[model samples]
Target: MPGSITGTIVDPTGAAVAGARVRISHGDQSAEQEALSGDDGQYSLPNVTPGPFQLTITLVGFTTQASSGILRSGENYTVPQIAMPLATAVTEVRVVPSRVEVAEDQIKAQEKQRVLGVVPNFYVSYDHHAVPLAPKQKFELAWKTTVDPVSFGVTGAIAGIQQAQNDFSGYGQGAQGYGKRFGASYANFVASTYIGGAILPSLLKQDPRYFYKGAGSKRSRVLYAIANSVICKGDNGHWQANYSSILGSLAAGGISNLYYPAKNRDGAELTFENTLIGISESAAVNLLQEFFIRKLTRNIPNYEPVSP
Candidate 1:
């Protein structure tokens, strides 16, 4: 003769839990029997084989419950009422920006940076662990620099000084001479800015921005700034030779020979000399940036200093 198992399921509040699944397994090698709790929270497993048996109760939104007992032939095994506890709830959240998106945001912040709120200081990054810019972003920065009002003003000043010194005597004098000088100066600016800051940097997978090292000894900072002229951070975030800026200076100088007077063009010699001068100028500017420029720069973000 077979036995039967019965049980009642309830929630923590002692309310009958309907639709709960109740299963009974015999200790012997026999199939398990299961039943659903009724509206009264009652469940029955009829015709279960006699012997040791286990009952398991389960419901959605509540923890599973289990009980064990032995049954005699033709016995009615009544399991005690099982009270199920509410299951613990869990949630997950994530909000991470892509590399390009992060770089774009950093670029927007950099564009707002100006020395004394007037000169564009867009090339420098105060964030030492700044993300690398895409090629399009590199060109965009170059374009912004070339079109800035201060860039034109600076180019005009350079032309005035050149005209006064008769440095490019080939251009002659008066307004026409000044106009030519201005055009030449502005051309140099555009070529160098695009070639070095955008074109070559994009090709060489290098970054053109000067990363500020605000946390270090004065000697170390100075050396870091000077060394940056010859070596720069690659897109991979590793330091490498700055072929972009070097070759860019040479390329820009060679392009100038086309517009410059025949007497003023020194060919490859002038190109190499100009490249060296550009590197020296970069070192000087970087030194100023490391020691003095940040204090004068406006709208700079409060970024943490990188490890020395």
Candidate 2:
């Protein structure tokens, strides 16, 4: 004679689990019986060979469960209600910004930086691990610097001084001379800024911004600042000779000869002299940035200090 097995399946909340698979197998026999739980979660297997048997219950989105028992011939064995726990779901998420996007964000922060809350300090990167800028960003920064009101004011001041000193005497006196001097000065500024800060840096894969070294002894910081005048961070993040600034100064000086009074143009001599002066100016400005400018700069991000 054969026996029967019956059971009800439920969820952890005790609600009926319909359409769940219920399978019964005997250890001694190679045969198995299977059934699907009804809408009320009831399931039954009739005429199952009686012996030692195991029941497995399976459903989507729930853990598989099993029960075991020994059945006597012609007995109706009922299993305790089986409750299936919900399966734990696993989900993975990843978020990452591209290098160009990161650089653009950093540039936006830098653009807000101003010295004494007035002058733009856009070329300085307070973030020690700042990402490299693309060629388009380089040009954008240069354009911003060139169009800044302070840049125009500084150029005007330089022109006024040159006019008072009669520095380029061939331009003569009065408003006409001042106009010529202003135009020449502004042209020089535009040429040098774009060439050194944008064009050459783009071509040479160099960074034009001065990276602040905020965690070091005064002497070490000073040396770093001076060295940076002739050596800059490469796009690859290694320090390399700053050929962009060096050559840019020479090129700007050579270009100035095209407009300057012939008497003032000293050819190659003037070019080299201007290049040396540019280097010296860079060193001085870098020193100011390391020691004093950061304190005076507004809208600066709270960046971690980098060690030497």
Candidate 3:
């Protein structure tokens, strides 16, 4: 005798799963029939044969489902609603900024940093693990520092002191002497900045920016700051001997002979001496940066300090 089977399909969320294919077959019989679920998720096999039967439901993007039951003759067999589990998505997504873009953003932030809201503190990077700068970016930073109005003012003040003290005697006294002194002083600044801060750093693949060590014991922080004057982070993010700075200072000092009054030009021995003095000054400045500069600096980014 013929019997009928009926059921509804739904998703795990309990929403109706429309258009699911439903099939039924009698045990020990080759006959099989199929029906699709409607908008209401209902499926029916009205002409199914009586006795034991197997029912299967399948849908695209969902796990196939099956059930078996015995149907009495002419019985209206009703199966429980079939819940279909959707297949897991196999897609992957990844988002990241390019290296150049990341470095550019970091440079923009660094350029805004100033000590006491007036002095440019662009050479220091509070982000110890900063991205490496490209050659172009290194040059750009050096150029910006060289042209800053504050830099010109500082150079003028130094030249004034030199004139007042009658230093660089070859240039003598008067407005002409002051002008020569000013030009020579500005030239020294430009040469040293470009050579040490940009050109050598780019060629040696070194980071020119001082990495601030803002946390740790006072002694350790002091040591870290002083050490940074001689040891610097490389483009590969490892500490290395600061050949860029050392060599750049030597180069700048050697170049200074060309522009400065011959009497002021330090010979090889005194040039080396002056280089040592410069390095000591760098160490002192770095110590100040670690202990005090950030507090006084305006527009500083909030970065967690890195430990040695």
Candidate 4:
């Protein structure tokens, strides 16, 4: 086929369909062509052989249509203009998205999707470029997680485990002892999450959520998730040192000294050690995020569709 078929395609409203798939077939064999319609509804399928053929047009969310005609050999055929009729009016209405508003709404929705249908999973945003939370919103999320009923229940469970394991033996074994351990565990979760995941992140204008980099080699994804612990996305949409995470871990550890048994409490050296431990914990969590959490999480939202 040394020649081509050239033509224009349009909808009833005369709007060019940019992504329309055009397929041509002749004889028992077939040939295919795809051309993006120009702004003015003009499209050209260069090097199409001169022959009798059929043009098949298709687009997503649209019905398929076809036209047949004969072409003279070596002819630059300008087929009759093809106008696609509206197949159906979909009742599904789509809203044009505003990026900032969409991110905010997504965050608000996530604040409600809890683990165990109770513990707030507010901090885990699926969006990589989520909008920065306002100061009040940050505290509100912290307060919500701190006071969640499941949080208290889980603290009791940990306290039970700790009692069985004699983890903080200085606290001793009794209802009173269990209460102390429970309080300490809950306090740790609250302090670390609020300081590292919320307050300092808000203050430093860093996103606390781990950005999922799903498209890459396994090694790259592993390194990306691990690197996220030390580097974070800033409000300026750039990567920088994760001051919020580092300082927050240290602050949470330092705050533990106020409640933990002195024997269990870290002196400044222990505080730094615990801070390192927290950073390591964050990397482990991010690794789980990269490979596991998305599967467990339900009702994952769709990304806003980018219209061409």
Give, for candidate 3, the lowest lDDT window spanning 10 residues.
23-32
Question: Over the stretch 1-308, how does candidate 4's per-residue lDDT look in tens digits?
Answer: 45677777788887776667777878665566666666666667777667778888877756788888877767777878888876686688889866556566767777676554545566676665566665566676778777878778888999999999998788999998999999999988888878977889887888776666765677887898889889988877888999988998888888888988878777899889878887798899888877777666655565431211
TM accuracy, model 4: 0.62
* Local distance difference test, each candidate: 0.93, 0.93, 0.91, 0.77
Best by TM-score: 2
Ten residues in sequence with the least summed lDDT for candidate 1: 20-29
Q: What tens-digit string does per-residue lDDT give for candidate 2 at 1-308?
A: 89899989999999999999999888668588899999999999999887899999999899999999988899999999999999888788787999999999999899889999989999999998999999999999999889999989999999999999998999998999999999999999999999999999999999999999999788899999999999999999999999999998888888888999889876797689779988999999999999999999999999998974
Better of 3 and 4 by TM-score: 3
- The whole-model C-alpha lDDT of candidate 4 against the native structure comes to 0.77
List model 3 lDDT by residue over 96-179, tens digit each.
Answer: 998888999998999899999899999999987889999899999999899999999999999999999998899999999999
Off by over 4 Å in 3: 1-34, 37-93
lDDT of 3: 0.91
Clashing pairs in 3: none
- TM-score (all chains, Cα) for each model: 0.73, 0.75, 0.73, 0.62
